[model samples]
Target: MASAPLNEVCLAALTLSIVFLTILWYKLTSNISHKEESRLPPGPRGLPIVGFLTFLRPNLHHQLTELSQHYGPIYKLWLGSKLCVVLNSPSLAKEVVRDQDSVFANRDPPIAGLVATYGGIDIGFSPYGSYWRDMRKLFVREMLSNRNLEASYSLRRHEVRKTIRNVHTKIGNLINIFELACVTKMNVVMSTMFDSNFVEKHRIDGAEFRELVVKFLQVMGKPNISDFFPMLARFDLQGIQKEMEAVLKSVDSILDPAINERMKMLSEGEIWGKGKKDFLQILLELMEQKDIEISVDLVKIKAILVDIMIGGTDTTITTIEWVMTELLNNPEIMGKVQRELKDVVGMNNIVEESHIPNLHYLDAVLKETLRLHPALPLLLPKRPSQSAVVGGYTIPKGTKVFLNVYAIHRDPQVWESPLEFQPERFLNSTNLDYAGNNMKYLPFGSGRRVCAGLPLAEKILMLILASLLHSYDWKLPEGENVDLSEEFGLVIKKSKSLFAIPTPRLPNFELYQ
Candidate 1:
């Protein structure tokens, strides 16, 4: 009788515990259901698993803008297993890039970008962290500081003058503007990185380099099924990852020898010409220093170099081509730019960087060009570290985000004539600039991940654009017209190559030499 009573007591205790656990689980699930009832942003409900994958087009920026129209400024879409959010309005952009910048600063790099950036260690593709901060700080202070740029001025000037001479030789003949700009910009980038002597020795600005840059960018912008479905990434079905790997290897081959040579020279205690450190030397020195807070390595250095090389050459060249195209399309605008060039930089004299400051009209023209055609229309993809509320909607953790600056720049509500090529809008606006402070006009993006090379890019772009207009009088080939059609990529480019005839306008032919 005693044992029987003890067994009943044990069974009763077990039954009570099971009842308690069930109540707890029911309460937790009910709370979760209430929380998720209406939290997700409004969006289209596509077909079962693949989602909106079939509706995408090659012009991703344009397509995203269209989607924003239907779903409002902030909307979510399911692409395969991925959840993507598109931000269209300026206020929403500010919210993410400013108020929640640190939360959204991380990059969800595509497979191709991961390979191109050495597993996303470069500043462009790296995650937001101490390492990224240190790398960017080093790049800004040591590589692209005003002092460093001044030291490398001779290299930039030499290449630009050489371009002027080359164009003079091709006077009255059809000149491919893209090719001309790409070669000159590549030379400037290489010379700045490794000094002009090293660049000349390696012939780093050859056609091969040009082809590689174009292909690399094309691959970067290409959409892959692997990106949409992570499970399929390892299979390499699209070959994008493999292609990027080959490109990175080729880039490595070019940069490796130059790096080794610089390291060797540094070991022997040799100084660069006039004791001025080129980009490579400075980076190598940082790598050797043990006292610094951040550690540097060959992979990081090469990744940075690749970022500079591709970013410097491709974007600058594309912008130059677009500026030329716009000017050609609107001859009156072209005349105005030429007249300003003549007034600021005399017809008898060649253009110089010093004259750039006085060319206000030219500055307006450049702002206008980027306003219409930001090199990076989508401004690279960003991701959230954790679930957060943005624009009154909950964005779940790790959703791919695209800030459509292209659409923001062309918003009819903000601009007077959004489609027109009017440079006057930016004339006196102090707030609107490449600084990325103004949400409405972020051609180079904004926030912690804003472009680090804007200063260098501004100087080079102004110098090159001014020089081309000042030294040469350009016209479309006879019976030909300007094509405003665009072909989008990592950098937006004109579908048709600009072929223009040039005539030297300088009074002194000796300047060509």
Candidate 2:
């Protein structure tokens, strides 16, 4: 009986080995034939089962740049089952974003994003189709048009002044610059999102909103194993999905009541003649319209609101932090900016929207800051709607494509002294505007999915930087140096919080108040 059992065990072991070998052989042949037929981009052949997933590190942008050097500009990597293609050169970036834009407009959003964006129905992650186009049109033409943004200037001005006042009280103490900017951005975005009367009557907690944004960004930036291996997505081993759901719930708790109140007010004609209706009021008005093809439901309204709040706050703050960081590190640049501000708006006067056009150097400083440290370094990942050829390599349908704007901005072939932080590079260059026509310096990306918030983002960023710099002189804490090191996530921020002391710079003390 023992001999018979041993023979059966041996036979089972042999059968398993044969099956494994047969499967391996079939996969090898199929991949070989596919490669010959597909002409796939060159890339590293990672380990058999896991691929390059385990080799990925923090600061993914830097890692991808390094890979570009070894594998040429356009390359592919098997990140588990997903095939990701990274485009490092401007030409290739243009090919995906401009040449074949429609084919590559859809987003392969992470699981966390889908949850946060109400199943990816928002402008950020919605698939490329009529729905996406309609939402984008609503956002660009109606919500963030110059008319609306101009009307909302007072809201921005008020929040920025409040931040200046708060900073004035904390003079001579170490202040966290990122935190300061974060609060100011959050308040400005909230004020602009809803009318003052609504915010005041609804008693929406700004602090709670800030906390929610922080948590949401944190979870969104985390690398979930589920994203790499879709088979594990249902498991959500990292709890990212759960965290995102909780954030959405919190977001809805605040937004739902406010939206309902706004709707109720609109029903009774309470919002008419309310000093230029705010974004929330405008969206509510659109929601009730029966003539439009795309019905603006409550979820769509809330999702767009979330997009403005989260997208507006984080990118604005991150860019401001980088601008301040770059200025602090390069004192001469900082001095030049201050001198320009003083000349443009006189030391006695405050920064106004009209003054922005004349502050050319300050504008260049912002451009250079974005060049060196774009908020979304790699930009949001895109997916092709169908099989397409990019850089002469076949990008199969549904491959994750990353236009490495970080690398393109720093390419020596394109930029002179690519690594330097010289704002002068952009001083008189009208060709390098943020409109995405110039593919080499796409800090805000290009093509159909370029940042729709560009108009509002630019206004707030310029206002914040001008206000802070013109009002206060910033210095690093005693015995400390400005660290330009970065921490990469959904957005790239300084690896460490920038702590600085501020002294009122203007001759007029009352300006701060």
Candidate whose lDDT is highest: 2
Off by over 4 Å in 2: 1-38
What is candidate 1's CA lDDT for residue 78?
Answer: 75
Candidate-wise lDDT, in order: 0.85, 0.86
User: 294-314, model 2: which lDDT tens digit per residue?
Assistant: 789999999999899887678
Alpha-carbon runs more than 4 Å astray in model 1 = 1-37, 202-205
Model 2: weakest 10-residue lDDT segment is 24-33
| TM per candidate | 0.90, 0.92
Expressed as tens digits, the lDDT of each residue in 1-513 for candidate 1 is 899989999999988955664454344324323464379788878654567888778777888888888989999887866778889999999999999999999988899989998998899889899999999998998788888888877878888998999998888999999988898898778777888887777676567767888888888878898888776689899899998999899898888998998889889987775765578888999999998777999999998998888766778999999999899888898889999988988877877777888999989999999999999898888999987889999887778998999989999987889999999898889899898989999999999999988889998999888899888888998799889887777778888899999988788998787
Candidate 1: the clashing residue pairs are: none
